[model samples]
Target: MSQNYPNILLIDAIPFQGGSKVATRTLLHELTTEHQLCIFTQTPQSWQGLNARFYPLYMPRWLINKDQGIIYFIKYLLIALQVLLRKPSLGKITLAVGASGPSVDLALYMLKPLLGFTLMQLVHGGVACSKTNARCLLRADSIHYLPSSRASMVAALARYGITDMMFNEPRFTPMLNGLDKSEWPSEALMHSSEPARPVIFWAASLLKWKGLSILNQALQELNASDANFSEQGFSANICYIQPKNIALEYDEPEDDSANIHWFNQPSNLDEMRRQSSIYVSTSQQEPFGLSTLEAMAAGLCVVIPSDASYWDLALIDGANCIKYRPGDSQDLRQKLEHLIKHPQLMISLGRHAMFISRNYHAEQVYLPQLQVIDSYLGAGSSKAQASITGVF
Candidate 1:
């Protein structure tokens, strides 16, 4: 409700790499085309193309002696007052909190009464699953977006009465829980003229939740089968040969079986995409499976774990991609065999996946957010009401 577009305040913690970064950055980029936008971030300059500056929440202590408790509180209070003094007008102030950080959320709440602003939280996985996160989110005015697929998350939310009680009307805005599309491999990188090995790519943080152990087991099975093929008169070329010595961090296994390649760190996103044929995800639970999307965009056929509630974000067990039971090494091994045996099928799947990924582009996602902003401004809730109730 001002003559000018609202001045949106984007409050986020530093290092915007995951869901929080992508969602917030996309929205800000879109809104800046028309609306006035200011970003307050811990890492102000890291993210490109933003009107941003570092916001210091604590004052520097000039005294020789250290301060604690009451003095610390007083110093923080001064910082809060400084932030408050710069608050945009009632209608112009729309604070968007992306992370589930309690301190940031609470600070936004304290500002609501005085600023007469609108507050929105870009909800990801934490709020719907954790009671503590749900309670923190109860302080916001609107939930702009979510990482969960519409069906599964809505059904789960119904159990908690979040459908009807949390807000006047809940809107399930779908968002990818994975990496930013901008970070995906480029067209040239995906369709390089240089031939790559028949790769079964598994890229992640190499942590337990990512299912590295299961992947290792699958590799063993693939190698065993490759050995059997070689014994039965199959040429070494016909058998899948997994290249070792791919990782600089870890030692090359002395006996890395044929058809099992282990990659550690990739210099860039394109390199990871280029050196692979089929990208497989072995995560026990992935809210949005960002790596899966990135692989799809890179034109790599994907085989993902079907255990997560959010697995439906990109379909599983079909033409576009394959899905095995989460943490099931046997299932993954079988899928890998199918892909290697029929490389053409894998290529087709990769093409289809790349086509489907076009919808997730930043330009398209940003358009819907502009609609949300228009709706919020039209409501004319000048009091900055942050009652996070649900609507069934």
Candidate 2:
């Protein structure tokens, strides 16, 4: 309750744990130093800290339960308005959303005038893929996008006939995702700064688009090769973690890389990272794969899916990281076998990945976003009239 500090409302609309949650917390960690923060999240308090008043959807009433909740979003919409409206005396109100969702974003947009707050949205690949995100971009006072996402979003707005307005201003800006090393579970931290064996790591919430099918088929081919003879088989264990329900229900492929298995997301991600020396990302539209960065930061030899979407990530395929064909199972299998055959390749690639990953740590990535927020919240700069209005 510092009287001198201004108030800002940070909203996280998704009701679960994911990359968006990580981004929200990382930004809040730094922003709290200068503002009186109000975080509205659906994640239970046990999962992470809340610096300001935390409003979650975990009420005792079954109707508000996250399982199939629609009414609760409306409830939260009201609560967000209430929070902003409650204190007219507080100076310089700002509204920041973790990721724009229909329920929260629309409601807040309608209330922006009544509540007297400037709006900012964090666009995490959603804008490039959906028209809804384009609307979110147009309505907001400012936008924070991943380095790869900024160009795509600007292009999207152009397609919507917003070319001149969007490019002329700093409305949409690039901001890379970052990690707080200390936020990871202490027990899951690697015992030594070296890689562990018997586990190769892959994870994605959206399995279908992330190329999980291709991974299985490729690993299946690898398993078949192993079945032909003991000498031809692959080495190393692989663990794939899919966020529950988001993944397509895939039956276990036969023998099929019998070493590879999928499980619900782990409570401690560091433990998952520690148990593996190699990490692979099969996502096709990965604007900023936060998990990929985490694996690289953990010193894992990371292989990224070969596709144009990955271009801006600044990953060097042959040297710093490995790039496998987008959907070619055979190509993936060959790459896997090569890594299995050459242990030194894993070490070298892993070390380089770790070195390259330094440029994207939270300390480095979140600075631009902070500067944007600070400028928007500053008294004189933010008073200019918004060119775009009305949600689509």
Candidate 3:
């Protein structure tokens, strides 16, 4: 049965590791036992221990920094040539491009015709309207995008005068990120009694769009009126990863509050989630909130921005999660204070969130996606396209 499975070449050209990388790793881990896999990534160390064979692809620093003009084109051409040369060694395989947008995987799109391999394009973020991106998107054999990104993709395609018929085509599929159930903390730990002081967990990169500043302001305000919020007061665990390959104008100030603890890419995030009573998400219009899902799996009461993202749409305020007005620090502060005031509400919410998290177990969520990929590999393009109609 394993021998019958098709070969897969997963491309990871992005310079930095983020949620898309995490999702790709999960999918690769799930596939390792059954399928032959090869990964082309700049960070080979991160792909270590996975059964997939890794090929080191060096993305230039200038390119990572988003440098443009002739130099960028030259660098990109060199990278494309390198991939072209290595194609023979990879064999006949389905090329899986996991990119934040069409632009990120443009090289793969350029190579698709020459390589004659089935292309699976997975878009992890909003799609931008560009002729190049639209062309790449249209050429791909299969496109997997998050629900939140659907509108953006539609808008991007519309720029090329493409109709909504593409969306209804079997090739376009909407998917949500999933969590590995094995990595989740024990159910006992997740449902453990609330601590002396409710510990809130907030994790994300310090990118301007992640709303870290809003969280910072909310925490500062909460700490200032700690006595008015809760009898024991609230403690916080802020896990922030520094953004790579981007210039930032603002530096996150060090919190002087004793209750607020900061972690710079901690290795034990699952353990932190286990100890936390509440989890807060501050990202504005997040394509998909994987951290929030993980927090829910950890049985932490999740408080998220009411920004119509996947979590915001799926979770009900005061039921599974608390939703505050997006980008409003005061609203966030008020929501947190309410959670702190009612510890039992936190526990109830945590329980419900954990229950909801089961729906997104990695295997369950990815099975249909994997089936779609397999269909693409097993049949001709036309047959595969028709086969995917009901699979997703």
What TM-score should be assigned to candidate 3? 0.88
All candidates: TM-score = 0.66, 0.76, 0.88
Worst 10 residues of 2 by lDDT: 383-392
Worst 10 residues of 3 by lDDT: 383-392
| Runs with alpha carbons beyond 4 Å of true place in candidate 3 | 1-6, 67-75, 187-190, 226-232, 247-257, 379-392
Q: State the lDDT of candidate 3 residue by residue for 138-205, as single tens digits.
A: 89888888888888888888889997788999889888888765565544253655377788889887
What is the lDDT for 200 in model 1?
Answer: 62
The residue-level lDDT of candidate 1 at 109 comes to 55
Task: Give the per-residue lDDT of model 1 (tens digit) for 1-392.
Answer: 23365566655433224435544664555443345555544455434675444453443434112224455345434544656766533235644444433333444555667766777666554443434345445556666545443443444456555763444355435444332334546642335553343566665554345566677777766667767642331111111112221211221222344445444343454664665677777666665665677777778878887775464455756778888887789988888777777767877788888777765665454445556666765643221233323211
Quality of model 3 by C-alpha lDDT: 0.75
Which pairs of residues clash in candidate 2, taking residues 3 or more apart in a chain or in different chains?
226-233
Pairs of colliding residues, candidate 3: none
C-alpha RMSD between model 3 and the true structure: 4.4
Which stretches in model 1 have alpha-carbon errors above 4 Å?
1-6, 14-16, 33-37, 44-46, 56-92, 99-106, 128-136, 147-184, 188-194, 220-267, 311-313, 375-392
Best by lDDT: 3
Model 1, residue 2: C-alpha shift (Å): 16
Predicted candidate 1, C-alpha RMSD: 9.7
The candidate 1 region of ten consecutive residues with least summed lDDT is: 233-242
Please give the CA lDDT of all the candidate structures. Answer: 0.54, 0.60, 0.75
- Which candidate wins on TM-score? 3
